[model samples]
Target: MAALLGPVITPEGPLTGQLAGDPFHPDTKHAAKALAQVVEALLRAVIGWLYRLALLWVMVDIVSFPHDDRPAALT
Candidate 1:
């Protein structure tokens, strides 16, 4: 995906052809880097929430189980 959008985002790419600017423009690179950081942070938060929810479910299951010393009588 990056390979395909890399050119389109760069200064010399078709998207910015009218500007006729350098391909390695600083502003463009900075924008992409910032976007990546935001995405990474969001993903980390989602994964952490999911992990906590799963842990809570396991704990509830463990607490709800009966701990009996005697076996059940025949029905």
Candidate 2:
């Protein structure tokens, strides 16, 4: 989902600029910023899905394991 939505959600900026071997080059900075934004968004989406899954698991567990408060001889 992130791959499809990232381009639409990410802000447009100087994707092309000075290209040099230096790490501080404008082009590199722009690329890095864009990549970081995409990665962050992807991570957030994953976290959200995981959270939902955990909630579902808890609910299922509760339903599957009902507490039996009766005495051992009651059966």
lDDT, residue 17, model 2: 24
Clashes of 2: 0
Mark the regions of model 1 whose C-alpha exceeds 4 Å error after superposition. 1-23
Local accuracy of candidate 2 as per-residue lDDT tens digits, 1-75:
634434322135423223234568665788899999999999999999999999999999999895997988996
Q: How displaced is residue 8 in candidate 1, in Å? A: 18
Q: lDDT of all predictions, in order shown? A: 0.74, 0.73
Clashing pairs in 1: none
Stretches of candidate 2 exceeding 4 Å from the true structure:
1-18, 71-75
- In candidate 2, position 2 carries an lDDT of 35
How do the residues 1-75 of candidate 1 rate in per-residue lDDT, one tens digit apiece? 645555465444555543435546676677779999999999999999999999999999999987675666732
In model 1, the Cα lDDT at residue 10 comes to 43
